[model samples]
Target: MENDCSRFVQKCHKCQIHGDLIKVPPTEPNAMMSPWPFAAWGMYFIGPIEPDASNKHCFILVTKDYFTKWVEVASYSSVTKKVVTDFVRNNIICQFGIPESIITDNGANLNSHLMKEMCAQFQITHQNSTAY
Candidate 1:
């Protein structure tokens, strides 16, 4: 039994490799193509910064269009799902028209029920980021 196992390891190409162990599957490069402006957007939160702004706001919510690199920003004391939804509704949808997709990190405020419902209503694809 021991000899068979030893022979199997010797014949295995991966076992012969002298480098860092690869636990995850090798990933192929994927091109993220946005067909047009306002087609895709990515959202992020800046900080609960020292309330430096004139409005005494501490948090900054910013979203940028993937194609045009156009950005929309707003500041608030605290960020909630309501705040996120309102920002998307007013800044992105109302101003630039509905986007094809919105991608955000898997934040609670970003991936709320309200956001999903809004996306469904607008026919916008909402995706939470995954480790890639």
Candidate 2:
């Protein structure tokens, strides 16, 4: 009887169309772990914000240490590869020492040749976030 009911449901077009949807994840979720403070950092750009007292500032570059949750931020008029590389060199590297790796979104400025060269010079691993 149970097998007959199962077969009946399987053969029912309306049941197949209107049945409860099964939710399956596309991929397994992995947690990011950092061994120590400033070991791994994530960097991203924010805005075309309203200019503040510093008139030249339009965009903000933000970096956060994965382990300690420490944040470093700087403002710039325009964001280029040079600006990003300089920020990583001056603010993050100089202030906290060299990080093992840096993660960033798939922005052209972050993934440019110049930025990659700069990271290579510092022996820091650069990784891009996966698109959803």
Q: Which candidate is the best by TM-score?
A: 1
Give me the displacement of residue 110 in model 2, in angstroms.
Answer: 0.8
Cα lDDT of model 2 by residue, 55-85, tens digit: 7788899999999999998888888999998
* Candidate 1 lDDT tens digits, 1-43: 9999989988988877953567868889977657899999999
Q: After the best TM-score superposition of candidate 2, give how far the Cα of residue 71 lies from its true spot, in angstroms.
A: 0.3
TM-score of 2: 0.72
Error of 1 at 31 (Å): 2.4
Count residue pairs with overlapping backbones in model 2.
0
Candidate 1 Cα outliers beyond 4 Å, as residue runs: 1-30
TM-score, every prediction = 0.73, 0.72
Candidate 2 structure lDDT: 0.89
lDDT of 1: 0.90
